[model samples]
Target: MLFSLFSEFNRVDAEDILGINADAAILVDAETGRVLYEKNSDQVLGIASMTKMMTEYLLLEAIKEGSVTWDQEYSMSSYVYNVSQDYDLSNVPLKRNGTYTIQELYEAMTIYSANGATIAIAETIAGSELNFVKMMTEKANELGLKDFKFVNSTGLNNSDLINHIDDGQQLVGEDQEENVMSARTTANLAYHLLKDFPEVLETTSIPVKIFREGTDDEIEMENWNWMFPELAMKHGTPAYKGVDGLKTGTTPFAGACFTSTASRDGNRYITVVMNAKGGDPRAARFDETKKMLDYAFNNFSKEEIFPEHYQVKSNKTLSINKGKEDQVKVYTKEAVELVSKKNEKENYQPVLVLDKKLLNDEGELTAPVKKGDKVGYMTLESKDGESIEFLDGSSLKVDVIAAENVEKANWFVLSMRAIGGFFSDVWGSIASTVKGWF
Candidate 1:
């Protein structure tokens, strides 16, 4: 799909000429959901252990739902143990009877890219790896992950393992299950997850570290992502500025793949490349990611599409229930940003649309409201009614609260109000009477 959502830029054909044999690629503005660059991004392709993005996402979701805790210890299962038995495997060496905290397992899975650690984590979080795979597929559908499947937590040789199933069902393990994902979709998933759960970056971005238990052997883990060092040298120390985490993946069938994300001065970007060909997939991904990042950071600047506290037209006050104050205040959560042409203010205009149903028919608000409550929404559209491209055409949410409360009116208060009204009326009458006599 052509992403006309953002203004297009001069195309770069270096990947083609340089023989960067990637089957699919995409670059996007993280905060605005703008597609900044793409090359065959929609073609479905095998993505290898970049599949772990889904695994990591599901694990975080499990934690959010209270199904798992970072400190909780879990036992290693037979399936995980068998997977670890491959001597050539880059295993985490988890013992069948030994236990590790969720945090330790997560580090192993993400940083060390330990297959056994991932399978154990899945089994621990969801009772079984099979059940966790089911959850992964279900959540994939929920998140609009159109071209993907999960038959195993470890992204192992499912193609060979499932060929024996006689049900004729397209078992995820058979050659029929080439766990596919498009560059755009993969980047979108990573971007959304990282944007929502930034803690993942905290683990993935570490350039190098040692994981150890006191008195136990230490395991050295290095960030497989190479863009950090490349950018550092190219830009001279802390290069690629805000560039940070993500993951790198490869397998013979999937070729090489990566999803890299970086943020600078509040602007974030995500780039994905799948099926690149080279000696080292991780290094290839790093080379491609650095090019994409340079293109973006050099060409674009984040422009605020809406100003903070910039009163949105049609915003209505909301009432409070049992609040210490009778009413509360609300506004947009954050100003939206758009990557526009160097100077395109004339092309920018944001419009507001409130969901009238959220307000009472009498035009009065009802509330037990908070500052960020979804009181209404506004859509920023182009003057021609075509939706704005950079804003992703998503409606911005507004809060519901009374800007301020009207002081209470009571019976005694009414009596005093009446007395004041009578005296004002008498004074006006005497003044007019005196003026007429004069």
Candidate 2:
């Protein structure tokens, strides 16, 4: 039961800490993947253009692997040309048989949520949209996302693709569907995307850029992430501090969805808001996101609860056998820092676990034990029996290690100790028998 404290605590939901008006939403620590706040986060819902985040991830991987290049040109197919011309959908117009650089198409897809540009990037990576969808599904599995389904690289509903046709041909497959995922799954994908390809922010954070600037085919592309300072000011709203690169998705089926990241005072967060409710769905997603961000920034601050080399007060040293020394002191391998509430320090207690392999039947180590050897791990438990679990199902813990070395005793020393112990036992037994008889 040494580590049972980790699994026995009641998981307290902090959902009541803030109110978010959305169908599915989640806020997580970007670096540690800790769940800050969640509301219906595990419910699968249409993702709309948020699907493009996956496309962005794959394209970045291809570029890094030398399989694709930003300057590489893609010739528009009849299908892509037709979809690009639909002004109803978000897109920059692409001319028939006119090729555009991968950089231009990526900018269009990420900044404006252009369907045609995203589709072209998918084809370039996987040779066709259907094949790209398979890759999306495979990558989702690889990222450990539980609730997700990807039917296309672009999050456009299958109905939209089916309706948009070129030369009497269907644009999508026979099954009509859109990409769907839970908020947790979406957040997990974002976590892996940022962890693997951090440079993506260099491009995604661009507020505005012109496609083919100063040319006849030029189009002004403004980022759809209205949370950005420039975009927020343009709409006459106050900008949220440290808001930056991410993606937004909106469609009649999916409502309004946004996956956003923000940083302040050395800490960063990833938040997702899906199917936000408002007359202006675009504004609603941002409004809900602000509530979650405010909660995280106001309540949580990093603190070192336990310093390095800290030892358990109850058990300072462990017994060792067959060595020159009788015991060895063990302490934490490093300091333990937690992004916890200001007043929650009193609730935490340390739990230590010893490695069974190092011990014999008497629960003592058979040395020679070396300095800095890993004895086990030190975990924590809440005194109130209520704890907030991590998103990745891992305990907030640190390794426990031996503080010094203990060399094995020589054979002569061992024989002398054994003979002294035998005479001492005989005298003690005879004395005990005499006392019992009297």
Q: Best-fitting candidate, measured by lDDT?
A: 2
lDDT of 1 by residue, 1-438 (tens): 122322233333344422335777877887767776777766666777787888899888889889889999987666666665555555666665777888888888888777778877887877776678888888877776655556777655565334323322233444544466667678878876886688898888877667655525367766666556643464333345676778777767777788888887666888888876565554566677777777777777767767655455444344543334444554555565567544554465655555567556654445444445555544455554433432133443433223344444455756776798899999999999999998
lDDT of each: 0.66, 0.83
TM-score of each: 0.68, 0.90
Model 2 worst lDDT run, 10 consecutive residues: 1-10
The TM-score that candidate 2 achieves is: 0.90
lDDT of 2 by residue, 228-339 (tens): 8888878643478888869999988889999999889988889999999865778888888888888888877676778999999976799988789889999999997777
lDDT accuracy of residue 251 in candidate 2 = 85
Where does candidate 2 clash, by residue pair?
none
Residue 348, candidate 2: C-alpha displacement in angstroms: 2.0
